[model samples]
Target: MVEVKLHDIGEGMTEADINCYLVKPGDFVKADDPLVEVQTDKMTAEIPAPRSGVIKELLLTPGQTVKVGTTLLIMEDSSGGSKTVELQKVAEAVNSEAPQADAAVVVLDRPAEVKVPVGVSARLGRILASPYTRKVARENAVNIMEVKGTGPAGRITEEDILAFVKLRDHGGASTSEAGSEQQVPNISKYASEQEVPNVSQRASESKAPNVSEVGSEVKTAAGHETVGKSQDILPFRGRRKQIAKKMVQSIYTIPHCTHFEEIDVSELIALREEIKASGNSISATAFFIKALSIGLKEFPVFNAKLDEENESIQLLREHHIGIAVDTPEGLIVPVIRNVEQKNLKQIHDEMKRLTKLALDDKLTVQDISGGTFTISNVGPLGGSIGATPIIQHPQTALVSFHKTKKRPVATDQDEIVIRSIMNLSMAFDHRVADGATAVAFTNRFAQLIENPKLMLLELM
Candidate 1:
């Protein structure tokens, strides 16, 4: 038997929730087979098996959070070895605290299960809740099990608590003891209330929502009313949860300020057409990427990050720009590395490759790693004219490029003329640069878009 520990899967992600278990005890598996799906802070990934084996036991449940390096399960390898011999080897390996540990894996014999106290599980129905949800429930003094959980397997979630609070208070109607009357279930005296000692501290941060909840009925200030439609409760796991985690961290840590401007892209459009006419496949995003790389060189702060501990700035020399791609799975930002080294065609081809891999769910951590900056083209998706985008964390800046259209603009001679104009919505970490610096970077970027010759010159 080998111990299956939760591996450190992503870029510095220390903990994750077991989103789902693909196998159960007694199931046979092959090496590289997906044993479970895990949702980390950065992404949703499948943890594959290291060796073929029959599952011995599952130590966790869905929505149960665990830290990296925690032993999640014990699986017996199907190598036709004697059970007693394998167990002996495992015991030896565990007892061996040698200076140089062997490559062979050791699995602990399953500990004897302590019978759950009588009447506890029967009363509370196990009260399974994510750490974040449990934290919220404790803060609000709500017994999580009393609340009818709308989550998978009747699991209580953070949103359930939020909705419960809202329905009880009726939009802050009264903060008296009266508000507590119409509340959820209470914990029985027998409920365990034992905390999982090994849970990650980040789980109690209250930054990310555990699930999306909507109350079926809410009391309006005038009176009570039905919500009219059945509400859908979505599990805040997988990619959505990852996005929420990063966005929350970004908003709380970075003092972000956006600089908005417009640029005429008629010349850039004409250049794209000319290239396409020559049987090339360069994209509009490639143009923006090249322009942004040149702009970053001109204004280094836009490509830099603020190191608060060291009280200094770290300016990155390479131009690895992340393109925010909205895939069916979720919003994934795949990085285009060393944009300054690649020509327009190269950028286009790489973007297509990365986007395809992302959509196909074949993108490895390396494919999406190492972004010095980000650009999100939210315009083509067709929602609003512009956007005040949130900065991707650890990176200092992100620019939201909106749709281009034939809009009337005043020429140098003050005559109104139609031009293909687009909006550039950019946000920068204030600690890294001031508004003037951000504007300077955007201005240089805009100039390159207006005149392709300058961008081509940068390439030379």
Candidate 2:
């Protein structure tokens, strides 16, 4: 028997998420066969077999993140006469009918089941982190090479990525010898270039202070202030980490200002009910998409991104509107492409299709990409009447639609009656366009929602 360890995926990769196993135990695979697809934050790569042999055992399961150089499997040597070991379902938990260790498994396709321990490997790959960790490091513009590993066998963990970032962000006193280090120029002294991302890496490597003599907030001589309670440290993980990164980017980069308008959609509600009665369950969101499409056509700035580097506003030709779907995994905005070209029925069907895919975690990268503008509905969540939603960074603007409620309204004849009203909250990048532009966009959309027929009048 020979041990098959995970080889280095890339120069910076320390680990990767086991996306799926192409070949299982009892299967004879040849050299260069794609054994597993592994994912890091930035890319997914395939790990191929080093030599031809029968797969004796699999050490990792799908979605199980493991470090590089870990024992991937035990394989029968090509020159040996051992029979191929039968395999068990990787997803199925090994029964404890026979007393054994935690990671022990029974080998099959033999005369008797042989119990073996598939322990974590101590072999270190060139890098020691999973691809996801490396990806986070790259997205934050932190170099993986600079991070110190703390996982088993001195492997890099997610916390290591965050630590490096924190150290760079909160530049405390340099622990290194000040005399030995080369002095770097202060960033504030120099004008920012078009490539802002490079500035950080330069600062990190140059031993230069970011601003005001390396951030007074980080005083190495004085330790951190004590908190009131004893705290438990938790990693920034999964959906929470993703949300934090986006929120931070949006808040820091976008000059956001919000505007709200109460739209009376009584007629729109009636139309929705009539559509439902006709055996078509279409949502008000579909109506809003069609309505917003008209507004976008008239005022293209709402469908534009402010290209600061070029000092210009990029008006997107396609009206791909993103519908924010709250999935169990996280909040994902699956875009409905070319909404302006599609009618209400088509939009509804696409919405249903994408929503199902999003919930099932089956959405491809294409399904969620290329959103010109975003619409986040608070109606389905059912708690808030209205909220100020943040823009989906670089998109320039987003519309927040609240739940519809019956409210008393005064008619043109001065007669009071109850009507279904919903709030349309618009948030836009103030740097790209002024308040007038955002307001005009919001008002036009509100008009269409109030009278759904107006959306069909100017089709496509």
Candidate 3:
């Protein structure tokens, strides 16, 4: 028998929660096939099979937290050898490299007898659907098992669940075919009680109907309403717990000071319009990132890390900007590396790529690390005035952009004019930078953005 243990994936993680097992007992897997999915503090990763083997037993259950080196499962080597040295060698390989991110994998809920192809015997009842697919089913209050499997090897898919929901909701024949309500998993028990207001674009664009419970009543798909429980509980261990811990650490450790400012972005908006008219498209956040890079060149103090042990603040030369993206899972900040070295188009494209990866929960470790400074653009979500933004830990500063509105403003000539005004909140570690310096940095950023032509001169 070969033992598969959880090793330190990266970032000096001591433990992780087992998200799910891709393979169950008696299933044969090849080398590099993902055996289990684990959620660390920063990312979701999968441990691959070290060699071709038949799964013998899973030592840990889903949602169980195990420390590093804990034996996760037992496997019978198909090669008929169980040398400990061979296991050690393969384990080292799995530890050295970062695990690949795959969020669409499913959980092994319960065993139900399933039919297979000719010459294949019936296996235990197993539902095969991605975490995302299951989440959708839970949101719709539909039992995933009731949906027919159209995916490979009788795996249930998101579309299958949605179709099933539609059929049942519209009073179709499938409603009767679906098992009793007792079999359906309680959506409130498994899903988060707090509605995610700022979920990423992919989740926001989901075609699933809104089945969210409202004031102890849930609106079902059948155009009827049912009374829900007065309260619901959600597990606190995954990404939400990690985020809370980091936030508490940051708030308690760092002496935070926020400075608010408003800038006229009329010219920037017109410039973007002109660019679009010329058949080129770019996001406003891209402009903000590039302009920040130039500003960082002037005020490098904000793009720095503080080391209290050494009593020194190290200013980073490269601009790896972290963009805070809100996902269904939680808040994830994926970094765009070397922003100073890339042009606007490059930065825009890379930012889009990272946002999509974060929404899909496929961001690797390198994608979220090495951020010298972070920026949160909550403007699209409609916080119009200002916010006391929190600085990412160990990093010196963070800036949050709020909604832009067309407002009347006095020009240098004392004449009133309509201008696009956007408010921003900048939070910095007081131990590293004072409020005056933070103001100076935002002023420099505003200068370049207010006059889009100024950015051209700063470009290489």
Model 2 spans > 4 angstroms off: 1-235
Candidate 3 ranges beyond 4 A from true positions: 79-114, 117-229
lDDT (0-100) at residue 197 of candidate 3?
22
Best by TM-score: 3
Candidate 1 residue pairs that clash:
146-185
lDDT of 1 by residue, 180-199 (tens): 21212222221123222212
What TM-score, to 2 decimals, does candidate 3 have? 0.72
lDDT of 3 by residue, 96-127 (tens): 33122111111133323222221111111124
lDDT ranking, high to low: 3, 1, 2
Each candidate: how many clashes? 1, 9, 2
TM-score of each: 0.68, 0.57, 0.72
C-alpha lDDT (0 to 100) for residue 105 of candidate 2: 27
